[model samples]
Target: MLFEKTYGIDLGSSSVKVYSMIRNKSYIEKNMIAAKGRKIIAVGNEAYEMFEKAPSNISVSSPMAFGMIANLELQEIVLYSMMRKIDKILGIGSVMYFAVPLDMTAIEKRAYYQVANGHWLRKNRVYMVEAPIADAIAMGVDLENNEGSMVVNIGAQSTNFSIITGGRIIISKKIPIGGRQMNEAVCSEVRKRYNLQIGTRTGKRLKLVMGRLADQHKQARKVVGIDSVSGLPREEVISAYVVNAGIMNCVNEIGAQMKVFLERIPPQIAYHIAKEGIFLTGGSTRIPHIDTYLASYTGYSFNLSDLYETSSVTGLEKIIHDRELRKWAQPITQRKL
Candidate 1:
């Protein structure tokens, strides 16, 4: 017999996160193993622990690149592993709902739907959901009206800006600025100035510990990285001021994209957005001062969706429970040839 709960998978670049409802609350988990080489040595928290600690033979890599599936085979591997992992916890088969970027073409979207089905590996009963739309639906944005709501998901490799009107993607933009870009830019900056090199894991810690986009007035934290001049291990007292500089590059790029989104809306439609402004999600938005930066730039009040990290995944709950949303979602998996 089939299980009753509907599960959602947010197939992310660096890791895969799953969210299912358990007793009305969202049950979520993620794997840190970046897919590289022939095998995924670690998944989820174990992989997260191995991120910087792992040996060279095991290089952690993100299976997805630029908001699309770059490695189909590894994706299947990790996905199947994750599905089985979930099955172990639930003790039953699940109806799956997976989300993809808004700008994904018809064929590309279908490919993800197929991945959700796990056809090659033998999983089934898959449903496809758009990332942006699911995010809005979970955020409680009005779906029935043509007034429209914009969701900007700042992820690891790419930023997705989608406008959903009547619960569908009418216009959207996918830009190549995300969490990874920020880390790389910081690494580049430190290397150029200090001649110091660091790993993504180190860069990630720097970005999170003191990552900021606000002014120099705020209290800053001193962080360590490779020293440029000595070529020896070094530590520098980094002010949040210093880190903010690296983060703003991406924030500015996002602002520019938001401008494009603003232009795409007609004057009448734009008026409605003026009332609601834009909603921000994804892992990057969690950075300090990002929300304030966008608000200051656009002159419009911007709000961040609750659970910005799990918004897309948990949002599918609203999608499946409602008939209208289910209509927008097509079952691409488990189809007979």
Candidate 2:
């Protein structure tokens, strides 16, 4: 008999995270693909390298957008490519657990099933696990308890606010705002203030370096970009204040929405959440003092998870290995269209 393998996969918009139960290791790669007119070129981190710098003939793009699978075909290709790299044996009878957004429609949920049942792994089994549930598990939240827990995941193109109680999700919402929007806001601020045209990647670097909310210490970083005024290449020193200004715009909006979301919760559940505070985990939450910043808006403390982008996959790892936690992962059955 052949040994079966199990994997936990989080197909995030910015990157793909996979955890191999057999290997007991996690893998992360940029969820990008580079192609030249239907011809395959590169995938994963290699493709990300050519993102802003690739020639006109070579197009680099992500198959996922806003935490959803935007292009099913390309998405399948990317997943298969990454799986091959992780393990050479694309053996039958393997099991896969995918962490998916809660707000996805039936059709959207089916897309995940399609990808798993696609050409590469037709004989494998697929399970669907809500992203927030996995995140909470990774954060060491006691989901089996009656206490309510709130989780916020800020990804590349979207932010998910979810409430979980008694091992089930109570309410969840996905907003089309996240790290991408923050990066754009940074670029926009730079253009308006210094007449410099910087790419989103540059803006991301600036955010990582200087994005602060509670602590507004002064800082600066030199960046190269196109001069908006002269249409020529130029280098400029950008202040942390400008970067913070742009980031706060998005953060404030999320906070305001979070406030409204919390208002609708029942008093009893709200009470538990108040005691436990909010469970925050995601890539965009990496900004310094962001937890403190959000605390001010919602009037609640936050427990920040250091797992960052890999929280969901890490949680899935536990679910796959532990029989008790496996109850949260449901098999994705085919739905008639």
Pairs in clash, predicted candidate 1: 31-44, 34-61, 35-61, 194-228, 195-228, 196-226, 220-240, 222-238
For candidate 1, lDDT tens digit of each residue in 90-195?
Answer: 4434577888776557667656755755544445467777788778877778777757677888888888888777757788888899998998877766666556
What is the TM-score of each predicted model, taking all chains together? 0.87, 0.97
- On lDDT, the candidate that comes out on top is 2
Candidate 2: C-alpha lDDT: 0.92
The runs of at least 3 residues in candidate 1 whose Cα sits more than 4 Å from the true structure, single-residue gaps closed, are: 1-5, 21-39, 89-93, 119-123, 215-222, 333-337
For model 2, the superposed segments whose C-alpha errors exceed 4 Å read: 335-337
lDDT per residue for candidate 2 within 1-337, as digits (tens), equals 2478889999999999999987899999999999999998999999999989999999999999899999998899999999999999787777899999886788898899888887776777789898999999999999887578899998899999999988888888888999999999999999999999999999999999898897688799999999997999999999999999999999999999999999989999999999999999999999989999999889999999999999999999999889999999988767542
In order, the Cα lDDT scores of the candidates are 0.71, 0.92
